[model samples]
Target: MSVSNPTLITFVIYIAAMVLIGLMAYRSTNNLSDYILGGRSLGSVVTALSAGASDMSGWLLMGLPGAIYMSGLSESWIAVGLIAGAYLNWLFVAGRLRVQTEHNGDALTLPDYFSSRFEDKSGLLRIISAVVILVFFTIYCASGIVAGARLFESTFGMSYETALWAGAAATIAYTFIGGFLAVSWTDTVQATLMIFALILTPIIVLLATGGVDTTFLAIEAKDPTNFDMLKNTTFIGVISLMGWGLGYFGQPHILARFMAADSVKSIAKARRISMTWMILCLGGTVAVGFFGIAYFSAHPEVAGPVTENPERVFIELAKILFNPWVAGVLLSAILAAVMSTLSCQLLVCSSALTEDFYKTFLRKSASQVELVWVGRAMVLLVALIAIAMAANPENRVLGLVSYAWAGFGAAFGPVVLISVIWKGMTRNGALAGILVGATTVIVWKHFSLLGLYEIIPGFIFASLAIYFVSKMGAPTAGMVERFDAAEKDYNLNK
Candidate 1:
């Protein structure tokens, strides 16, 4: 249970750097656009890395390792699926979103873009989408908080409740002050830290275990199944799990990065950098988990009692194998994963409440000053709700994150994709898709008798709902003209 002082020092430095970035970001904030999207001037490198890090979240630390540790190479396919999905999303969505968002005149939030694009004069679609964002993101944020608590509890020997609050407050404080710029800047730093730690820790562990061949032999001698990528992995279970990549199609924080990029041209470079980082980091995480078996077989006590909690694989390895300084760096890498995700969710949630609801409906003429205060207040509210939810301290991080993720992916993913590509997509179709998609996910997760993965049912129902509704509902002549005009203009511009 003992941890080294050097590890604590490394943590202090990482936390200090995060807070400083937030304080500096506060100086640049003057309006909603600046606070939420960095004034639409974020460069390719910052946008790409920040978005990827936030998207991966604590799952990169806790869930990925836990999967590899318990299930072995069978789980690596999830990383493969995710990388492919992310590459496609960036290629198809990033540049167009950046161009169209700016073309729509400084749309600061996702709901804002939806409202403007679909011309939701009654504000129904905007309100519905915003509510969905808040509900699922609250759960998503709570998952990150829980992961942070677990990390602190494991490394610092703190109580779960204390760690939960410390993690939430630390992330929220800087996010509240600095906003999007702060989040993006810290994400870049954290992403670098996370990648380095993931790579170095595995290499150090592999070398210490007498190289890859010996390491494999040791692991195989202990558990033959640990080395098999297809062992005990069925088609449905594999597809249902790895289909998590589909959730990327609709994640607000991820799209927010696209919307904030300095220009459309930067997206190509951004994609290359982001994909390279993801492949390397995710691959390293898988190796560390798989390699831990061999290392632990040689020296079990030093690795601690990891059989009880697979999520602690990386932390246990750090404690047993590395010097205190390197262990601290690794711990910070996990924290970086947690903080990057939490900050993004908090900002997205606050934006939904402030721009989508409070300003859009409650106070149409609210001042910039009032809007900023409202956004800050919303951040506090979202944090409190997530803290209450994370009180259990043992809720699986992937379970919580996945539930919310399915909600977003099922409800908004199809609508976003169709709206961008199909001129025939009507407002009613978009609204129908959003409602059915969101509702299906909620019901599938909590009430369905079929017992399928929520995303499977939710996604299927959502797609059908959009198609049926769009086909039955007649498009007005003006609406048809607008669609035609928009498509023609888009083609001409391209």
Candidate 2:
């Protein structure tokens, strides 16, 4: 079960190139700003691709395709929900958050922005938000590790423990060296590789399985339920699937791209590019899974043990469809997807620790260089924690992703959305929303309540908590002034 020499060489070259990019980015990283936010200098294309790459993670390749392979078309609602949510986040939250964060004390992290936005002198807002980020991101980071482990085990036939370390090593190295700039630059390349793999794999699968009609007929003959979109469609299922979009407004990694954009003006263009890439990539991901069903129907022998581990569909398909060298390159795209998102998550976790905790509480007078090093140290720490969590071979990448995704979306989504659009949102209201949303998610998920996704209940409760609490509390004149100024500046910029 050894890896082919050609595949090993391709992987080595890819990993080496990533490390080189980290070394190069090190020259430009002179301050904490540069280390955490790329010095707020990313262009539209890089911002769009980096954000998309970080948002998709290995779930885009492994978790997503696996879901479709196992569940048929009912799983696609999640994709549709994500596309719609992404568009709205870029449209509504991106420009406003960019201008607002810079205006409100030049806040760097999400917690920094939240504390400054409400003028929470007691630091309660900062503490709550930072804890939530660390907690959910730990789980989110574990999902990426699981995806990477699955990729290595499937492609190279390595033990899960060996594959877990191998998958995390390169990502942690680059992030430790270059920070945000390294993450963004490598993400651009990874994003390109991801799209190429998603697009090319499906096309090859279709060709090898004959035409579209023939593929469909074969799939239908094998199992008519595979093509039935309505087979498992229910009100709860559809809403829960589409609710995935709502999580976008609150995702710290994606919002970091907006905050780091060159200017508010660049966001519109970035949104268009990001959305286009997302649609094509998501469609391609679903196609790979759907086509795998057909291909396996025709040539079941090639599927091997994928019936038990359906996530291996993409890996198995590539091995059967392409030459050894080309298949190696295609498989490397999975690693690209894994690394791109894992690096960003680790960086965000670092920023939350360094900026929100260390700089704010431990040493308000710390030098920029000192803070940057602390950030790099935290990156390694968080990656190690995630690696430990991902050591379990039975973890399903999608299951981990869904839990963490719901946590972030429920905890932060309603508060973030309300903070930007509504001027009357008080500090107490923000605190209440964070606590209620996060608590609801934990409780709902732990108990497996009502046969519905935790996000639906968590999001509703959080939003309700914010509204009612804000109504009960009074906003200060200073808070009103700050909101007005942000709104005016946003309008003027537009």
Give each model a TM-score.
0.95, 0.98
Could you say which candidate leads in TM-score? Answer: 2
Off by over 4 Å in 2: 1-4
> What are the clashing pairs of model 1?
none
Which tens-of-lDDT digit does each residue in 288-386 have in candidate 1?
889988888898766555888888888888877888887888889989999999999999999999999999889999998788889889999999999
**Clash count in backbone of candidate 1:** 0
How would you encode candidate 2's per-residue C-alpha lDDT over 258-365 as one tens digit per residue?
999988878889999999999999999999998888898788777776788888888888888899789889999999999999999999999999999999999999
lDDT of each: 0.85, 0.91
Clashes of each: 0, 0
